[model samples]
Target: MFTPSSALTLEQGWQTTGATGSLQKLKKFNNQDFNHLRTSCLSQGVLFEDATFPAHVSSIGPNLLPEDKLRRIQWKRPTELQRNPYLIMDGVSRFDIMQGEIGDCWLLAAVGSLTLQKKFLENVLPKDQGFQDGYAGIFHFRFWQYGDWVDVVIDDRLPFLNGRYLSVQPRTSNEFWPSLLEKAYAKLRGSYQNLHGGYLSDALVDLTGGVQMAFSLKNPPPDLEEILKAADKSQCLMGCSTSGPLRRNIEVRNGIVQGHAYTVTGAVKICYKNGWKHIIRIWNPWGHGEWKGPWCDDSPQWDHVEPKCREALLRNKDDGEFWMSCENFQEQFSWLYICNNTPTFLDFGDQHCTKWSVDSHISLWSPVLATGRNYSPGAVSMNPQYFFKVPDYDPKPYNIVVSLMQKHAEDMHNAKTLKIGFLITMENSKVLEQFSRTRDITKYFTLSPGTYAVVPATTEDQEFEFLLRIFMKNQDYNENSNFPPSPVLPMDVPRQNQDRSYKAVFLRYTKQDSAIDASQLQQLLNDVILQDEMTSLGGRFSFDSCRGILALMDLNSNGRLTLQEFGRLWRSLTKYMDIFCKEDRNHSGFLDVSELKSAIQTAGLAANEQLLCLMALRYGDAARRIGFSDFVCCMLRLETMTNAFQNLAEGGSQVLMTAMEWLTLVMYT
Candidate 1:
C-alpha cells in the first residue's frame, strides 16, 4: 500500500548536503502476503509478477544480467529443482551453504557464521515458509532493516544454469532457499551488482540487527579467549578475515585463502597429549580449501588426540572446515568480527543480583537540521534524547548500558559506514550537566539513582534511522523506572504563586486580560473539556468536578476561585497526577486492581493481593471503579504515611514497626 505521498515523504530533505536523495522504499511482503499477492496476480491472468522483484533483474532482448553474463539464465521454480525441494531441509546449518558463480563470499561467510547461533538463526530464517504448505510461486524472508523487522518477498522464479542454481545455493541440490534469499537481498538493494563486494560484518549486522565489533588479531588482547568464550555464551556470531591491505584476490597460503572471510564456529579448551590446549574451529564458506596446518583433517596431530575427541571434531572430507590452536588463530586471522545480539531482558549479578528495566527508541538524524538549515537558527537538535529515572532508595550506584546503532548506513553508502556517536547526560531538578560522551556505539556507565537524559547523535551531518536501547540495572524496577515527578513550579516563584493550578488559572485569565470570576472560570473549564477528552483529574471531568476542586482550594472562602487558590490546587495534585498517569495503563482515566497494585509498588509501598483487595473494597464503588479523585485521595494518605516513615528513618530511629503499629501511626498521621 505504498502511495505517491509515501514516496514524497521519503524524499523530504533530511540533514543531508546533497540533492541526490536515498533510493525508494521497497514494497514489503511476508510469506502469507506473497501467497495472496501471487493468487491475485494469477487470477488476473498475469504470467509474470515483478512487483516484488527487482525491476532490472534480467537483461532485455539478448542481453544478460551483469552477474550472469557468462552463464545462460533461465527462470524456474522450486518444483523444477532436483533433490530436496524444501526451502529448509534437515534444518539450517553451515553444510547447507554452497557458494556459486556470484562473488559474494562475504555474504556466504556471514551466512555460515549465522549457523553457529541456533536460536538466532531461527529468528532470522523463520520456519513459516515451505513449498508444500501452499505453492503459489512465491516465497518470503525476514531481515532486520534499520530499527525493525522487514519481510521481503519474491516470486519463486530464480536464475538457473542448466538445472542448477546460478548464484549461491545450498549443498543439497533441491534446497533453493539460499539462492532465493540471495535474490531477495539483491532486490532489497537496487541490484545484485550493488552487493558484489562488502564486509562480512556489515552483512552480519543486516541479517541479525546485532552490533558488530572488530578486534585486531595481530595484537591479540590478553583476554582474547575469555572474550570469545563470553561471546559464545551470548550467542554472538563470530567471523574472521585474513589480514592485509585491500586487494582483488590475495594468494592462498598453506590452504588458507588470504583476504577471505571465514566463520569462527567455536573456541574450545580441550585435553590433548596429557595436557590442555586452546583451539579454535573455523569454516570456510567455499566448502573447500582445508587448512593444511596442525589439527587439520588427516594431520598427524589427530593420531595422538583422544579417540572421542578426534571423532567429535572430525568433519574432514574437504568441507573447508578446520581446527587450529588459539595461538595459530591469532597469527592467521587479521580482523575478527563479533556480532552481539541484544537480549530483550538482561539481569545483573548472581542470586542477589539487580534486575534491569530495558526500553528502546527508534529515531533518525537529518543533515537537514544538523547544519542549522531548517527553521531553527542555531544547530538543529538532530540529537535524539531519552530520559530515565532512578529512585533514591539505595545509596549504591546502578549500572546502565546505552547502545546506539545507525541502520543500513554501510549498504546505503556503498560499504562506507556512517560516523555516529552519542552523549549521555545526567540532570537534576535544578540543573543539567554532562555525564559522559562517547564515539563508541555501545557504552556502559555507573550512575547514581536519579533522572538522567540520554542523547544520541551522529559525528557529522547525515540522515538515517538509528536505534537507542537503554538498560538500567535496578533491584526490582518497573516500567516507571524512567518517569520522574513532574516539576510545575520553581522555588523563585512567590509563595502565593507557588500553587500551579492558581498560576495556570491566572495565566489563562491574563491572556484574555481579565480577572478570576465565576463566568471566566466556567468558560475556561468548558474550553478545556471540549478540547481534551479527559483531564488528569479524572475520566470526563464534569463541570461539578471542576467546581468541587476549586471550592476545596479556595482558602480565602471567595465565591470564585482566585489565581492563588488555583495555584495551590494545581501544586497539591502534581504527585496525584503522576500516580494517575502511571496507574492508568490504558489511559482510561481510572485505575483497576492490577494498575493500582503497580502504582502502589512503584510508590515504594506493599502491594500484596490482600492489601490491594482491601483498598479496592474500601475506595471503589460497587462496580469497583476507582476514579481520579479516589486515586488522588488514596495516594495523598499513602504519601503522608511514607513521609512520616522516611522522617523517622532519617531521624536516627532504628525501630521497626509492626502492621498494627504502622496502621495506628498512619491513622493518626
Candidate 2:
C-alpha cells in the first residue's frame, strides 16, 4: 500500500513508460503510496495519468432494462458499495471472484488464480487501499505491460446492474477488489465493452511479468507430472479453458461450461485406504457448475478417509470449487495456460524472488523480396537482429531466452489474430546456424561463451509492430544498433585512409581493359598476400592458402574477373579481414577452438557444439588449429551459399550443390 502526497503528472507518467532509467532511481510504490497517488489524483479531479488512459473518456448512453436483460444500471464508489469497503474481504481466494454477464471469465479466472500467490497479488492490488481511511474516488493498480510494470489509475466508478456489479462480482458484497480490478482493466483497454473476451495468457501476462506457455490437452506432454512439479515449485499461475463456441452460462454435455475458463488452484495426491489418488482442484468463474464425478464433493471416495482427513478437504455446496481426479481434468480441459514465474538466471540459494532486467524496442515487420517473393526488398529484411556477447570462460551454466511479442490488434472483437512466428540463428564462421523458432513467445537455447546474433522475423509478409525481449544469466553486449545493414557496407569502412588504400589496391591490380584473365587474378592474389609475416604455423603464406584464395575469387569458372566483380570480391575480403583481426586475440594468424567460435559469431553465424566440433575436425591442423587460409575458405563458402539463398529468393534457378563440389569447398576450407 502506498499513499503519495502528490500524484505523478501526465508528462511524468509518460516518461515512466519503458524509458531508460536507473533501477535504484525508480520511485518504488508501497502500501502507503498506493492510497497517496489515488488521493492526489482525486484532489486534482483528474483520472489517473498514465498511458492506459491517454485521453478523457467518451460519452456513451447507458440503458436500464435494455434488450439484453431486465435490469437498471448504476455507478458507485467503494464507499457507496459498503460502509467499510476493504479492498479484499477476509482473505483473497479463488472463491472471492465471480463472473458477471461479460464473456471475460478468462481475465476473471486469472485474477482468481493470482490470489493464490500472495506476493504477486499484493504487487497488483496493493493491500493498503480501501474506501475507508481518507477515502478517494480514484484507485490505481499495476500491470506488467510490454517489458515494464506500469501503474494504471482509474476512478472508482464501477458499473452495476440492478444495484449489483455487472462485469465481475465478489463472493461477498464487501469484497470490492475483484470488481474494482476488472473496472481498471476495462479502462486500460479503452472501455468496458473492450473487456468482453480475451485469452487467459494475455491477462496472466498483464498481471505477472512471467513467461506464458500454453499446452494443448489434446497432445499433453508425456512428462506432465515433472512439468507440473516444476511449475508448482516456481509458483506458476495456471488456468484451463474448454473448447466449443461460447454461450452465456451454458453448460456442455457433462455439466462443464464450454468455452469457459477455470482456475487451477491446487494439485494433490491424497491417500485412500488402498492407495493414493491424484486430484486437481479447479474453480469456475461463474460460481456454479462443478465436476460431479469421482473425487468430487459427496463422492464415495471420501468414505475411506478419516473424519479429520475428509474435513481437510472442506467440501462446500455450490461454491464453484471442486476436486476431480487428474485423469478427469485432462479429459475436461482443452488448453492449459501456465504463467511460469521462474527466474531466467540461475538461482544462487537466495530466497528472495528474482526480477529479470527487461528491455524492448518497438519495430515493424515488412515483406522481403527473398525467394522471388512479392513486395519490397526493404520489407524482406524486416527481421530485427540483436547481438549478445557471452564470455567463454564463465564456469557457471547459462542460457538465453528470446521472446517476440506483436502488438495486439485493435479490431480484436471482429478480426482474427494474425499468425506470427520467428526464427533465431547463431552466427557460425561464415554461415548462420538455425537455433530456435519463436513458440509461445519464448524460446530457450544453450550457448557457449561468445558473441551471438539473434534474428527475429515474421514467417509471412506482413507489416506490424512487435516487441523483442532478451533474457540471459550474466552477459554484456557491445550493441551495434544498426541491423540488416545496407549491402553497400558503409559501417565496415570507418577509416578513410584504409578505405582509400583498399580501393587503390583494387584499381592498381585491374587490367587497363577493365578486366583481368585468370593469370592476372592469380598475380593479384599473390600481391595481396603479405609474405615474410610470421604465421601461427611458424611460416609465411602456403601454396594451399593461395589456391584457396583463387578458388574463392573465381566465382564464375570463366577464368576471368570483370572490374565490377573483382570490386565486390575485394570489398567482401576487406570486411572479412577486419572481422578476422578482431577475433584473432593473440595475433596468432590462426584460430584455436575458442577463437574460432568467436570468429564465427563475429561473422554473424550461429555455431552449436556439434557444428563447432565438426569445424575443428575438418579445418584444424594436426595441432588442432585453423590457419588464416582455412578461415578465408570458410568465409568464401558461406558467401557462395548466401548468394545461392538470395537467388532462391529471387525465384531464380534452383540452387544446386553436388557431392564433389561440397567436398572440394568444405574439405579444404
Candidate 3:
C-alpha cells in the first residue's frame, strides 16, 4: 500500500549483466570477450591485437599533434622499449603514475588515488596478468561505465615521440604496468586525446563504480575536517583542484596550477609538542609540484614536530605528495571531490550508520519525443518523468544524491555534449543544478519525508541516451507508475465497409501466400487509409516508418505479416478511427492531448498523466496535435504492449523480469 505521506526508500542502481557473479566477471568491451580471445590467441600461438581499438593514427586522435602526420611517432611493444621488463616490479604506487605529455591529470589524480587502496586496484587491475608467462601482448583493465564494469582489452603497444613516451610514464625504467594501464585507459575512452581533459570525479567513479560528492571549499563547511577524516578512514578516493579553467595546466601561485587536478591522499591531525595541527595530504598527478605554504614539506613550522613524526609524515622530495593545513587547503582549493564505493560515510547520525540505497533508470529521448525544454509546463511535462518517494523518518531530513549521466553517443565523436539537467518536484526544498554539458551532473538533496518526481531532460530536440540514478537512505521506497490498471472498454471490430476496403487493398498488394512485405504493407496502407478523407495524415508514411511498423508487428520474426495478422490489426485500426472521430469534437483535424487521453480511455486502456504525457510526446507533433494516422499507431502500440504484459503475467498479479529479459520484451514487442 502507498500513501502520499509515506516515507520513500530507494533501490540500488541497475547495471550491465553478463557472466556476472564475481569480481572477475565483467561485461565485454567492443563485444570482445576476454576469456574467448585469450584462449584462441594462446591456442593459435598468435599475439592478440584488438582491431576495435587498433594502435593507429586514428586511435591516437588528432588532438595530440597540430600536424599528426608531420610528427615522427613510433608505436612499440614494452619489450622493444625496455630490456628486462616486468609487469609489476615491487607493487603499484602513486609514484609510478608520472604524467608525461598527456593533459589528463584529472585521470592521473584518480589513478594515483586508486593505487592507495589494494581492494579497488585489484578489482580494476586484475593481478593474474603479467608480461612474461603466457604473455600474448594483450592486457585488459576494467572501468565502470554508467553502471557496468567493462573489460577494455588493449595491446601492449605504447606511443612514443622520438624515444619518449607520450602519455603516463613509470618511475622504474623496467616496470611497465603503469604505462600499459594508461594505454588500456586510453583505449577504454575513444583515445588518449579524449582523456586529455576530464573531471577527477568522473575518473574516480569509473575506477570504483562509486558515488562522488563534490564540496566547494571557497566557503568550507564547518565540519569539513570531520568529513575528510571520515572519507579517508573509509578508504574513499579523494581529489581537489585549484581555481582555473578545467583544461589549463599552467602553474599559477604557490606551486598550484590553474585548471590542474590533484588527489587527496589522507586527512590527519598530527600532534606536535605544543598542539595538534589539521593536515590535508595532497598529491599532484604531474609528479613534480610543491606547495611552499605553512606545514609543507620544508616549512619552518616542521621544526616543532619530533624527528619520528618528521621522518614518517614529511618528505622533502619532488614526489608531488605534500601536506597543507586544512585552513590553507580550504582557501586555495576550488572544489573537493570524494568518491566512495557507495556514499555511506557522510551520514551524520554516527550511531545509526545506515548505508544509502540507489536505483537507476536507463532511458532515452527519441526524435518524436525529444522536444528540448523551456519553462512551459507542457514542455517540461513532455520530457521523461520518473517518480520515487524519499523516507526521512528522523527529525532531520535524510541525505540523498541524484545523478544524471549521459551515455556516450555519436554526437560525442566530434566533441559534442548535450546540455542536460533535471528537476525535483517536491514540497519545501527545491534541489537543482545549473545546466552544463558534461558527462555527469550530480546534486545532493536533504529532502523532507515525502514522495517526489524526478524529471531529466536535454536542452535540444536531439536523441541522446541517459541514466537517472536516485540514492537515499531507509526503506519502503518504490515506484508506482503502473498503478491504477486499465479499465475494460467495449470491444468492437472493423466496420463492414472498412473491412472490405482493407481486404481489397491487401489482395491487390500481398503475395499469393496471403502475406505482405514491408513495402507492400506501406503501399497497401497508403492506398487504403486515404480512401476516405476522414483519415488525415500529418505526413505520408515514409519507407523507414513503414519498416518500423513491420518490425513492431512482426510476431513470427519473419520479414512480413500474414493475412491473419493483418486482419487482427485491421480491427484495432478501425476501432482507433472511431475513438478519434468521437473525441475530435471540434473537427480540428488533429486530436490534442485531452482528446487523445479521452480516446485512450474510450479504447479501454490506461491514460495516466505520465503515460499520456509520453503519448503526447510520441504521437503528437510540436503543438501536441495527434493526427489520424498517428493516433491509430499510438493506440495500437499501447494495446499491443498491454497484451504482451498480460500474456507474460498469466496467473501472476504483476510481471517480473531481469534487465536483459525486459530488454528482450521491449525490443521485440
For candidate 2, the per-residue lDDT at 44 reads 80
- Model 1, CA-based lDDT: 0.58
Alpha-carbon deviation at 592 in model 1, angstroms: 7.7
RMSD of each: 11.6, 17.3, 18.5
**Candidate 3: which stretches are off by over 4 Å?**
1-25, 68-70, 245-248, 272-275, 306-309, 366-373, 376-381, 395-398, 410-412, 427-434, 475-669
lDDT of each: 0.58, 0.58, 0.70
Kindly indicate the candidate among 1 and 3 with the higher lDDT.
Answer: 3
Estimate, for each residue in 1-669, the C-alpha lDDT of model 3 and write its tens digit.
011111111111223433212344466777787767877899999888778777777677775677744267688888887777888888889988788888888788889999998878988888767877877778888888765678878888888887898888888888888888888788777777767766777788889877787788886767788888888888889888776654557786688777778989989888866889889989998788878888888898889988787788888899988999999898888889888765654654455435565555566665455333554455555655555555446622337778888765543455355677777765423355345566677777677666666777777667766766677664322344221111111121121211233334455576333478888877777776646555654555557667767766788878888654675566566677778778988877788888887887887776566667667777678998888877766776677677676676775656567433543344333
Q: Report the backbone clash tally of model 3.
A: 6
Task: Candidate 2: count the clashes.
Answer: 29
Q: List, residue by residue over 109-153, the lDDT tens digit for candidate 2.
A: 888889898867877876555666655666777776544565556
Q: Write the per-residue lDDT of candidate 1 for residues 1-669, one digit (tens) a residue.
A: 011011100100112111111112222432236556667855775544455453334321122244554345677766766543888877778878877766577778888888777756765675666777555666676665543455667776777667666678778878777877787776655455545555666677767756566567887655678667656656778888885433244656678777577888888778888998888889887777878888888788888888998898778688888999888888877877777554211222223334543445555566654322221212323444465555555523325666676554433433234556655455312122222121125544556666665655554566666666666555554445433222111211111211222333455555523236555655654554334343333544445545655555555766566443554444556545666676787867678888887877776666456656766776666866577666655655555556567677789988587543563445332
Question: Candidate 2: misplaced stretches above 4 Å?
Answer: 1-72, 247-249, 305-310, 343-363, 366-382, 387-401, 408-416, 426-440, 443-453, 470-669
TM-score (C-alpha, index-matched) for candidate 2: 0.57
By lDDT, the better pick of 2 and 3 is 3
Q: State residue 178's C-alpha deviation in candidate 1, in Å.
A: 1.6
Q: Of the candidates shown, which would achieve the greatest lDDT relative to the real structure? A: 3
